[model samples]
Target chain A: MGKYLPKAIVHSDEIDRLLAVEPGWTKKKSGVEKRHYAKSETASDMGAEAVKKALQNADTTLDEIDAIICTSGTMEQPIPCTASLIHKKLAPARPIPAFDINSTCLSFVTGFDLISHAVANGTYKKVVIVASEIASVGLNREQKESYVLFGDAAAACVVETADEETTGILAAKMETYSEGAHLTEIRGGGTKYHPNFHHNEQDFLFDMDGQKVFRMSSKVINPFVDELLQEADLSIKDLKAVVPHQASGMAMRLLQKKLGIPSSQFINVIENYGNTIAASIPLALCDAIESGKIQRGDHVMLLGTSAGLSLGGMIFVY
Target chain B: MGKYLPKAIVHSDEIDRLLAVEPGWTKKKSGVEKRHYAKSETASDMGAEAVKKALQNADTTLDEIDAIICTSGTMEQPIPCTASLIHKKLAPARPIPAFDINSTCLSFVTGFDLISHAVANGTYKKVVIVASEIASVGLNREQKESYVLFGDAAAACVVETADEETTGILAAKMETYSEGAHLTEIRGGGTKYHPNFHHNEQDFLFDMDGQKVFRMSSKVINPFVDELLQEADLSIKDLKAVVPHQASGMAMRLLQKKLGIPSSQFINVIENYGNTIAASIPLALCDAIESGKIQRGDHVMLLGTSAGLSLGGMIFVY
Candidate 1:
């Protein structure tokens, strides 16, 4: 796993000052100080960079990739899937099929689960899952609470089968509660509110009821994680580490406590990267590996709650 | 398979008069004389309706669905995957996973391929795939040529392994050529041209180089379909029917001539439905089955070319 962050770093304090928010608001509310924002770079461009770095980290070349799956919450274009653009820059000569899986913030894990099934069914060999988000582009500066919790970044991973049975995804679960679907949304750009229909400027920006999402996730996350562990016939203690979506520092803490995982066993990067949407999990995984929190032959769990009011968990052996 | 077309019917003649198009121009060019448009229904609403009809058509209940895969070229909301919204309307009490697979117009086939792989891998028991497109909302009146070729419709399919080995997907192939990615696109509402940044109304509407797409598809479709049949150890004669993406009547005729398939084997509903984007394939399939062109145990092929400059083919026993 590898991550590519934009060079133009914007501090939350700066935004707070501009919005006339109290000093230290973002840090205290979300544990985010500064985050990167793409300047003259699209999500696909960032994805291409992340994919290149991921290939290098994996010690592999583009031709080795059998397919490309772009799971980003934000896409560069509304026509061609972002994966196609990323592939053009990464492996233009290869005829590998590319598409997109979008489940908002949980897109990466959902994509990983799909890739795992495809690999198990012998449909693919080396699949590259790239999740690049340009959240800053849609951030509502007026909605300071949610805007300050987002950052632009990308992460990619080359996944393949392991030599041992102990490796690979052991158990996975995904569920969406659309009853809370309106909790977080971008009202425009989709069919419901087309730009041609003369929608308000705010309709085009990100809107969120952060408290509702948090409350709903709190009620579901614990039971969902426990059931997933039980179904896999493993206990939380057996996991070497848990790499969760870096949604917010407070959310991560709550998840850590709810899952009964020690603080040391949880990977948290929200303090720096903020909520990178679909890239959060893989980015956290990369952070865990680089910091030696996750090692070979260890059991690690990737979990997250997405904007769809969707919760997903996947346990795997590294 | 099932489709939900809005009650409101709009003929090309009406559009021609509205856009000051030459009388009979649309039918002469694309064979789209009349098509349905959603007067008030949204993509997700149409998708939900389609899913309900699909469930009834498949004689399955909501709880029987293991997952809901939304593969529409247009979505209802930007945050929650359309699958989640459809799932909310279809089975609010169920905890089944919901997500999206997007590859522009080819999303349905791409999603079907993924669902087939998942079912084969035992990750899912039954899946509901819904493709709903509200193309009417994004139609650029200025681009009268492509605009008049599209309609708003939704299609859904319930997929599971067949009771016998003679059924299910027999062979599938998907390939993308990124060089033609810009041939068809909606330049706004995405990261490349965020709605937050000022953009022209036309930028948010669909744009296409029809000639370029036709030339590219002509160069690739025949060879790709032939290779797919060869790899599957089957011939064109083995297929009882070929349900293709009803992009246009002329395009379908060209494909039939190029592939050497008889007109009787080809399924075209463009005259009534126009190009419903991702729903075109499944919608055509349902039309074929209902019209008795495709019968159970018959080998049927679903093939199409998408905006990614991608071509895909899947032969399956009906």
Candidate 2:
């Protein structure tokens, strides 16, 4: 992997409590500041903000973006997709392609992959990818095990042609494992238990088998990373930083050990951001880029694993 | 556009009505006598069922599938994607690559596009794309405009490479109109309007401006269809059927008038399905295949539009 597009970020502290949740009965872990939770944060608001910041960082404007692929909008509380919402919010003068990418926490990477392909294929010149999450609300807030494990955030990156170097997106792979879905799930909405206008209580809460999920993560995630590394033609020794999903301490530690990446090599933000799910990876990247953890021509890997039991990893050059 | 892959379908009619106020709505859909629905359906249940049907239709087990992409988990719900829910249901089997495809209702077309590309590119042979929607549960049963316009159902397609004469997918293009998002949306969910564990009535109900949506459909849908036809170098003269998003009679009729497509050439099932949204296209296709309304080697177009104010059209030669 080689060069990367520049990015920047801004966040709120209220959302961070959810990001810094300690595991059920365990001390907090990692470099994350605790996630940014919005008091009334919505995907569009966060996406707009992040896009503003990213464009500011790039010293560009919305008119310059060729396209924007956003991965946000949860069904838990149900609303119009963040992409559509953002599209509406966009200045009419800046009418570019924008749509929601719904691939779990891996959505950002998925957006990353799609934008890269679009750019690589020369279909679009400059693409914007945003990973925004407003997850703190759909939770069973009283459930200590899950409530604090999330925050609200939106992170964006602008990808464009560069003659200077070759450190952008190099290789990426996405997979889904339905067999372990029950390990973690928000049991209500959708076709099975379609929410009614009546809003039934007993049947509409998020449920999960924590142990089962931790086990599933242990079983498939990092192992998947190893496969991605092989595909990218790099190894743990080659990567400058590893930006993985922000789910929990249990899943994170197991992944770190399996990959043998040192604490520093791991771009950790979970301690402060708990699990922003789809928003975590890019949020971390935004923070890392700002903190000087990732620089031009550096090789990095972004991995994701979440609700669909989906796992994906990509090799990114800087 | 050249090769063929018949997307396998999984279907059932069990407990379809329990999800509806007019429990009989399931069987009343145009040309659709029965369909799959959860009694208290969750996205996972519908998605899982469709995956099972797809597995059975394709004569392949879970382990054999390379990927599964789907939609419809928004109850503002969180934890896992509807894709994960299906993956979890395919238990004790090896994990399959999976993710959700959501550009809103066009998810079917989007899912099809992804599967087709992977197969054509020789990266994967078996891919499952599912669109499960229990829209009925999200809107008020009393709102005849909303309730009478929705039916809870799911559709899955297991696609694979095939040399069989003319039985498969064709070319597709996806487009989004993020502008119309406000015309149709579930409105509450995510960090913005957290689902009150107490069953926020506002959170559960779907909000749509029927007249505006109709206006968009009337004004834009036909143009979208015409563009696809023109791209294919064909015309209304070339299509045996046009399966549109099952939204409403007014929209469909307006489309038929604008395109000058005879009522016969226009597929009708919205009255019964009540706009299954993403499920409408494939659901219509399933019935067409089984009922012989659309024969082998026939040309058909699948069109989708939903809350994202998103729009997409695909021309399939099946």
Candidate 3:
């Protein structure tokens, strides 16, 4: 696992000044002390950096990778999937399959779960799944709720056929309740509200009904996690770590309490990174791995709620 | 397989009038006699319609599907994958996994190939892969080359575990040569060229260097097809039908000639539908199946060169 955080660090104080709010208000409301912001870096650039780091960590080269999948919530461009651009930046010696698998903020979990099946079936020997998000680009400053809750970062993992029988995905599940799809969305930049149609600038920015998303997610997450754990015949106590999406500080606290997971076992990085969208889970995973909170042979559960109002979880042995 | 065309049927003469060209010039230039243009329909609306038709053809219901994957070059909105919206429209009784797999114009081929592995491995029993493209909404009127070369349409297929021993994907391959990524693209509507930056309307429109795309594609296609055939240990003569992307009339003709596929065995729909982006290949497959050119036991090859400068092919028993 690897990650790339943009160099420009914007502290909560800076956000408060930008939003014309009182000091400490940003952190009090959003729980984001500081977050990375991209000034000139593109999502692909950050993604490539993360990929390179992952390759180095694995002691492998691009030539050994069978596929590159970009699991991003937001794209760098509308055409030619972002994975292609990342591949272009690396300039791999051979042509490998590059594509995007998007399920909003849960994209990384979804990609990891799906690709594990392929890897287990011997369809691919090794693959790189990268999640890159440039949330700073679409923030609506006037909407403090979403504006202060986003950050720019990229995370990647090199997944290969497990050499050991125990080191693979045990169980994975995803369920979408589309009734909450409207709770979080960018209304323009697509055919339904294309820019050519003269939609206003506000239409292009990110908008989220945080309260509604929380209500919908709260109603379904407990049962969804139960189903996931039941599939693996495991309980919350068996997990070494729970790396949930850094959606929000309050949501994470509520989820941990609802699931009865010990605070020591739940990974939290929103204080420094905010919600980096799809990059949140993997980024937090990387932090947990580096901090020795998770190690090889540990049973880790990746869980998240995405913009689709989807609940995704994967229990795997690292 | 099933498809849905919008109610607005646009004839070449109408395009000629819009472009102030001589009568019949539109057909002479773009080889499209008539194409569908969406007036009030959304991509998900057309996609749900196609899904319904596919479900009816398969004699099944949404309740039987294990997953829904939207493979499109364009999106209906920028958040919550398009598959979620399609699922919302269907209003499935259960929460099945819904997501997107994108590789631009080759999205449907990528989705079909990837989902086949899941089905074969028993991860999913039945899956619906839908490609919906609204190209008309992004056409640049001043650039007659791409402006007249696109249409709006949706095509879908129901893929399930094959009951017969020989009915499965024989071989599939995808390779991306990002050197030609710039040959075709919509440079905006994403973080790199965000709407907040005040990029002009042209940035969000589709742009293609037809000559470059042709030249680059021609150099790699023959060998790519040979590799696909070699993997299956079969020659081109064994293929019952070659369903290629309806990229352009000229490009398709050249590809057929280069691959030495007979005219009768090649499925061509550009004359009626133009290029539907990601929907083109599946749309052509639907037409071929409807016309009885491809049958249940026949060997069919799906091949295309997409905006990623990617070559994708899958040989399977229909």
Local error of candidate 1 at residue B102 (angstroms) = 0.4
Interface RMSD of 2: 3.5
Q: Candidate 2 recovers what fraction of true contacts?
A: 0.55
Spell out the clash pairs found in candidate 3: none
lDDT of 3 by residue, B1-318 (tens): 889999999999999999998998888778889999988899999999999999998899898899999999999999979999898898645688899999999999999988887788888999899999899989998889888889999999999976768688888999999888777899998999987785688888888899998888788888899999999888989999999999878788889999999998899999999999999999999999999999988999999999878999999898
RMSD of each: 1.2, 5.9, 1.1
Docking class of 1: high
lDDT to native, each model: 0.87, 0.64, 0.91
After superposing candidate 3, which stretches have Cα over 4 Å from the reference? none
Candidates' DockQ values?
Answer: 0.81, 0.39, 0.79
Comparing to the true complex, what docking class would candidate 3 get?
medium
| Per-residue lDDT of B192 in model 1 | 80
Arranged by DockQ with the best first, the candidates are: 1, 3, 2
What would the per-residue lDDT of candidate 1 be over residues A1-318, giving only the tens digit for each residue?
Answer: 778999899887887787788988888887898888999778888999999888998899888889999998878877888998887787777778989999999999999988888887778888899999999889887888888888989999989887667678888999888888889888888888887785598988999998899998888888899888987789988999888999888888887877788987888888888999998899889888878889988998999998777999999888
**Between which residue pairs do clashes occur in model 1?**
none
